[model samples]
Target: MSGDHILETQDLTREFKGFVAVNKVNLRVRRGTIHALIGPNGAGKTTCFNLLTKFLQPTSGRIFFEGQDITREAPAQVARRGVIRSFQISAVFPHLTVLENVRVALQRKYLGPSFQFWRSERTLNVLNERAMELLHAVDLQRYADLPAVELSYGRKRSLEIATTLAMEPRLMLLDEPTQGLGIEDVDRIRQLIKKVAADRTVLMVEHNMSVVSSIADTITVLQRGAVLAEGPYAQVSANPAVVEAYMGSANVELQGAH
Candidate 1:
């Protein structure tokens, strides 16, 4: 693995029974960049993500992170090495206040294993300033005192990002940060993603081509469990095989990126 690449997969494959969901994928994500993994449904994007996070072991090949082979590491082990997946892995609890939610993740990072409910309030308060800072980074500082369940879907996503931020990841895997939101919220999350990627590497599996094109430093297109194209938006979007795989109106969405 090169120093510039924060994450690398060497011919990674995953098989479910006789079906090959992710087949021989070779991905190299550069440090401090936003890389987008996109494909039509059942293209194995999610499977690839699961493999990267060690949520699913690869049937063949290897995964390397920061020059070390991490193929056999457990999910928690990989996470400790600074790969944090938001939304799923760093979920925000609905009952906890936004600040408290972030504090829980901080507790995991600063105080070890999560949900240390018996810890002194003074010890937990030690994390509040940092939690507020993370909340501010995601533009959710004003919602710190509010219950997470009352937040709008977009705000909830922001809170999730804030919690993920508390873990201080070197590589953040965002799964559809803008999946369900109005145009205004979509724009807000898009800008937030760019801002967050400023100091760390981001690898995301996103459906919105416009979002991918707008912020992704590199885009990888997957089809039928394999990589079809990988490059900047302009290059991959113009590839004929990529266009054909997208098939109908999705081609328009791809071109719309231009």
Candidate 2:
């Protein structure tokens, strides 16, 4: 990993039984840029994400963050290295107030895994100021008092991003940030991703070609677990092989996305 790139995978590969799910995938995400991994369904996009976060270990090859070999690091160890992942599904503490959810993350950050819930309110109050700031960053400060469950689906996703932010990640791996979103929510999350990427790096597995075209600085296309094309949206989208390998009907959508 050079100073110009925040994350890199050297022939990263994963297999299930006898089937190869990810094959010799070399990914290089530049520092402070929004990078996207895209392909048709079953292109091993999610599998690649799991490999990076250690949710699933690779069968071969290595992963590096800022040049450190993290191929064997545990998930917690990976996260501690400032590599945080947000799942495809909205992951929020439904019962906790929006503010409390972020505070819990802050507690984990400041107090470690043994964060004291039994501590005095005065002690915990110190975390509220920072918690509120995280909420404000995601535009959820107005809903601080409400249970996360009460929020619309889109807002719940926003809360998830805020909590991820509280972890102070150097590289955020977003897994389909707009997976089930409506048009409006998709737009909001797109802009939100771009905003956060201004200071830190982002590597995402996104299906929406429009979002990727609009926000991604680089796009890597995978086909049957291999890199089919990798470059800016314009360059990748123009590749004849990319157009042929694009997820069926999405080929039309990809063209229109531009």
Candidate 3:
């Protein structure tokens, strides 16, 4: 693999009771780029993600991050290595205020399970300041004092991004970030994602072609359990295989529209 890639999977495969979910799939994500993984349902996108994040063990093949082998690492070990994932559902603490949520994330990274930091008012002041900066990064500073659950759905997603950012990930994996949102919410989160990705690499699985086309520097199309196409949006959209794969799918029609 080239040195430019931040993450790479070589001949990655996963099987479930003889059912191949990901079949010898090789994926490369360039450093500091926003890459999107798109495919029809049952295409093994989720399985591939679980494998990369170490949530599932690969039946065979290897995963590497920043030139080091991580295929055998535990989930928390991989996360500590700077690969973080955001779930489809917002991961915010519902009862905590937005600011408190971000603060908790910061604490987890720096304080671990030690409660001594909580006893130090001075340390908390420092953490709060850092948390506010992250909240500002996601445009959630204004909602810092509100309960996390009180924010709008889109804002909750923003909060999730803030919490993810607090972890200071090198390669961020976002799963269907803009799903089930109104037009304005979608647009807002799209912009937020672009902003956060300025200094980090992002690998996202999204159903929204418009969002994918607008932000993804590279696109990888998965079909069945293998890669069907990989290129820029324009190139991948024009591939006959890609067009045929999405032919009957309403959501993917936007991808081939041009």
lDDT of 3 by residue, 25-119 (tens): 99999999999999999899989999999999999999999999999999989998999999888788899799988888788667774435355
Candidate 2's C-alpha runs over 4 A off are: 117-120, 250-252
lDDT at 145, model 3: 93
Q: Write the per-residue lDDT of candidate 1 for residues 1-258, one digit (tens) a residue.
A: 789999999999999999999999999999999999998888998889999999999999999999999999999999999999975333578898999998988998678786787889898998999998999899888888999989998888888888888889999999878886788988898999999999999999888888898999999999989999999999999999988888774423777662
Model 1's TM-score against the true structure: 0.96
Error of 3 at 24 (Å): 0.7
lDDT of 2 by residue, 88-125 (tens): 99888889899888888898878767767677878778
Error of 3 at 204 (Å): 0.4
The total number of steric clashes, by the backbone 3 Å criterion, in model 1 comes to 0
Q: RMSD to native for every prediction?
A: 1.7, 1.4, 1.8
For model 3 the TM-score comes to 0.95
Weakest 10 consecutive residues of candidate 3 by summed lDDT = 113-122
